[model samples]
Target: KNEGSYTIGKVELEIKLVNRGHVSGNVKGGNFFKASGFADMFGNASKDYQPQTLIETPILAENLKPGESRRFRVVFDYPPYFKGVTQFTRIFAH
Candidate 1:
């Protein structure tokens, strides 16, 4: 959450993904990870507090068997004008 009146700065995040499913899967083609900024922890927003697309990028193609894991790094340039409000971030894989 940005406690300041102005945009704080860029936030970098690292995530570790593991394939715990029984079958092997491949991360290829258009598979991607996205990060979204929300107004609150519940992921709700109003007209004045809209959701922001922090970052979105395609993941490198890799075949992961069960128990295999991969690391991903992402940088999000925090949105401006969100002031003194609680903020939340959510990551999605598709």
Candidate 2:
């Protein structure tokens, strides 16, 4: 929840994986959403201005007003059928 008096700045999504090829997912920011940009963990670290996200629809939200909260949904599939494969997943909102 946005507990401040002023609106929050832009929002970004980040997905990280330690050992894996690639994973796909979906994210939606309700109705009042605007996809400003998308980036992978590496792209974000390297400060690359490119859309390399795995989110199916990386719909970024508009101004997150004060004391207002928005809903988001994330759906992803498990790693392929394998054995002894570890996948470290992390999702962050910036």
Candidate 3:
């Protein structure tokens, strides 16, 4: 299981979305154990804030157990274009 899920910062923007993973359950379902995240655009936290994006990692595991955590690589379908320019150029890439 290499491909994981997405975890973004705190902000809200309307962008095209791609189906990532469905996270549900308290015990049996796999809640995100660990996940990498980013913002829709590149910019400083003061100028541009990160918003929560959906997870897009493919689940290779056949079954999810309780207390089990999954990893996901979250990405947005479209780039975060705010105002007039793209915001990612200034964001620190992980």
lDDT of 3 by residue, 1-94 (tens): 2123533222222332322232332223343223244334442365645333333333223343433444534344543432121223121112
Q: Mind giving the per-residue lDDT tens digits that candidate 1 earns over 1-94? A: 3333443233333333322211223334344323332334456535564443233444432343334445655543544432222234443322
Clash number for model 2? 0
Give me the runs in candidate 1 sitting further than 4 Å from their true place.
1-62, 84-94
Candidate 2 C-alpha error for residue 7, in Å: 1.0
TM-scores of the models, in the order given = 0.27, 0.40, 0.20
- For candidate 2, the per-residue lDDT at 32 reads 23
Candidate 2 matches the true fold with a TM-score of 0.40
Scored by lDDT, the top model is 2
Between the candidate structures 1 and 3, which one is better when assessed by TM-score?
1
Query: How should the candidates be ordered by lDDT, best one leading?
Result: 2, 1, 3
lDDT of 2: 0.44
C-alpha lDDT values of all predictions = 0.36, 0.44, 0.32
Candidate 2 pairs with clashing backbones: none
Q: Pick the candidate with the highest TM-score.
A: 2
